[model samples]
Target chain A: MGRIRLTLCVDDSHADDLGDIAGAARRAGMTVEQELSGIGVLTGSIDADNLDALRAIAGVTSVEQERDVTLPPPGSPVQ
Target chain B: MARKSRKRPAKKQAALETLSVSPPEQPQAGGSAPATAPGTTGRFLVLFDRSAAPQAPNTLRRVANLSLASAADFEDGIVEPEGLGGADAVMLPDLAIAIASAPPEQTHALGVASDTGILAIEPERVVYTSGQGWPLNTGPAASADDMAPLDYLRGYRDAVNEVYDRLTGQHDAEAELGAEAVTAFDEADATWGLQATRVVSSQHSGRGIRVAVLDTGVDSGHPDFAGRAVTGASFVQGESVQDGHGHGTHCIGTACGPERPGILPRYGVAHEADIFAGKVLSNRGSGTDGGILAGIQWGVSNKCAIISMSLGAPVQVGQSFSQVYEHAARRALMQGSLIIAAAGNDSRRPARVAPVSHPANCPSVMAVAAIDERFAVARFSNGGLNPQGGQVDIAGPGVDVRSSWPRPTLYNTISGTSMATPHVAGIAALYAQADSTFRGRVLMSMLTQYARRLRAPARDVGAGLVQAL
Candidate 1:
């Protein structure tokens, strides 16, 4: 709808470039929240429309929306 | 607060039908075994600059000269950082390098060292075990006279004998099965076969290993774990550490149940493994992604070896995996915690097979499929519909699985990929105990490598049925 939290995965080679990553996120109209160095991942908030542009950034491996994960309850039929 | 035992109201008794293990007629005993000490080696696995190690041998020697004895043990731990801080540490040799510290401290040190070429620094993380603050909810308590030193000795002897049974696979298999067990050749006693005889018999109990089960809460009152240690936390907003729902108790029972089950059909796997119950899902058996991720992070930060999640929401036939969960799983693996999740139970009999669910579909998370006693893939288990990662990674006994339930109902038999996921988690714990090297991705590889491949399609069963030892 408006803005949603997105997890942006970075290529191993470009993982340490915080300035470049921040610039790319800003250009894509996203605000970076956290940078996970050990696994080369960045968490940020971005509009749904800018998702495609964020994915196209250099060294960006993938950009996926963070969504709620709910477990199937007991007695729910599999079929 | 003093933990109180729970009693099922008398009105609910008529509705309870699940078979329960009658209390053993054996003598009452309460001897406590001395707690085993934790491992010492993985405390500080600091990675330094290998290229620089040779060129700047003097720097290495100077750093090794620190008073701490542990620093000298890592003589060969070094690697080159691809980026950041390489120039800083290399240019300023006078700056102190922290080899081992807590996570927050190590992160600061790594940030500084990365720019100077120190490569990487890994701090030892704390892993929590269960059976701590939360006491049994509704189980019997022995008086001081009943817990005499002689009784405690008898209990110790009994524990040793049970360990011997686990090693030799010697037990009253037929009598334990009771009257309800399928007698003909059509079915093997799941209690003896699926997790017990075939898996646990080959290895010692998963003692000293830290296992985290992220699911609906567990029955803190289950009598089967009278003196067992279980540390638990609830991520569900309004719930406490107690398992209001029975699913978590059932799953935990299979993964870390006692070898000498007070009831019939000893269905547990890694009996002695330290159980860390993280209640990600609520008593209603449902939860959001944030809670689940928080639970995963808790397990990783604690350095739990195996995190079993018998939970998942269905996905479309060709949806991409969640990058966030995938990254969480990857990071957990790096921290030596392997996560095993349930594939969706959405398949249609004789017609369609649903895709694996969200987090489970992630490449980094192991997706477990459900199988019945006949060694056939359960009709409801999801199939690998996506060409890439949304596929079943392994199979486990799920159909009509009998395990512990919330008191005073005591036990129940339910079927789903949920039941199957714990089997893999329990077996993973056994593998971890059998070989010290089995942890993280290596443990995962060993599980599928040793699995007993079935006749089902690869998409349905991944590598095959998970094996122990």
Candidate 2:
């Protein structure tokens, strides 16, 4: 499986333990990129095959894939 | 005045009979006031037990009366008189509650109300509205009859000449948007959304508030903003703050343009607001997550009251929300800044209702939908039912909307939730200006409460069209 960027939502109660919780991703061969401390979310890339194991980790609420965003192109039927 | 011993009407009785009362939840923290601040003579809304009789309405009112008789705000001060009269109490049987004036001594009030099987007590919200011709300004003076007729004509000529000279000088600095538009602009009322929201009549111009527009930068040199207070920075590497794409300029114009443009119709709202243009997207209207996140951090750190982003990428159906952006938005809100983003124009309405886009799909960010002049959902405006996170929060004028643009094309007509998002942002600025107490969640509540309820479904126009003042 290929590496994929993902966003993880951690339970707010366990937000203070993000450093320890992030070890789970490292064990699963994921590279944690950004730690959004305010909202209790972390963004990183992980092997697609390890996604299931990542979800089972404690304190992890949700895992969503990071995707690209863009503006509405010119003459792209905005109306 | 005595309490009127009126019977519960059949309709009200039926509603109260089915309403259930849940246990009290933890009150919101972070400087949020208690549900009922003690000793204040403000109204309190008390919830009753679901299985309680329809007559429980009176029971809740009585609880408030007893609680008010011993409130703390005035306990050791004045000996005020009071009666929980008919006019002082209002019952909403459908919601199984009654709102009555009281001194909000929570310990006493909650204990009394709970005895009557009450669920919770909340302060009656104060609805804010920008009254007609609010922030009133002096109108044009009339000519005196005693003055010579020629003098009156001269006076009028001088006034017109002065205004004309100023307008020409401004417009000449930049190319005219269009000759036809110039003729129509002066005669035009506020853009449809502004008119619908009553922003045109509002006197609160978002003065002293900083509004950050994070998008494809803005034309800082635009004539409409010749003397306006604007600050900007570019997050996109190798790019300047100048807007090559017109999207940022148009969005900025709608959210914080001048009250009266040199030659165009009044298209802007929040006219006096300070503009903070953050270039998150590249000139090509594209940017990565890092750039946008940086922009968000910048806006919040500067203590902006409102952050408007008329940009986003599509989110697939059934896709989960971006936790990263959600946290960023929550942090912004906690810091007293509101982030409003476009709900995405990916829908092919009457065919497919696409989900709201990323960043906007996050709960903390207010997602704005697009409505046309007819008040119908625009063909491209996304709908609710994403099943996870993306949902429309409010609607704004989007179709065939005219606003400022990049140079050489000083104006343009476009449509999308992008156009609508700025409308909400601008109205938010007005709300922020009208009341110093309004910020973060309270500001959001004021917007929804004062919104003009539209005929569309909640999925189409969450709380309906956002109102001004």
Residue-by-residue lDDT tens digits, candidate 2, B1-469 = 3443233233322322232222113354542333322222345666777776375644644653332222223345332335343254545555666555533342234444445777776544433253532222122332121134455466599557657867777433111100111112223656666777788889899999899999999998889989999999998889999998888999999999888886657888999999999998888888877667778877888889899988888878888777768876877898899999888888886668899887788888898998876677887888776855578888898888888988777888888899999999998999999888899888888888888776566787889889887
- How much of the real interface does each model capture, measured as fnat? 0.35, 0.45
List per-candidate RMSD values in Å: 23.0, 18.8
iRMS per model in Å:
3.8, 3.1
TM-scores of chain B alone in all candidate structures, in the order given: 0.60, 0.63
Which lDDT value does model 1 have at B184? 32
Say which candidate scores most in lDDT. Answer: 2
- Candidate 1 — which residues are off by over 4 angstroms? A1-62, A75-79, B1-197
What value does the lDDT take at residue B462 in candidate 2? 86
lDDT of 2 at B126: 34
Error of 2 at B16 (Å): 35
The TM-score of the first chain in every model comes to: 0.76, 0.84
The CA lDDT at A68 in model 2 is 58
- Docking quality level of the chain pair in candidate 1: incorrect
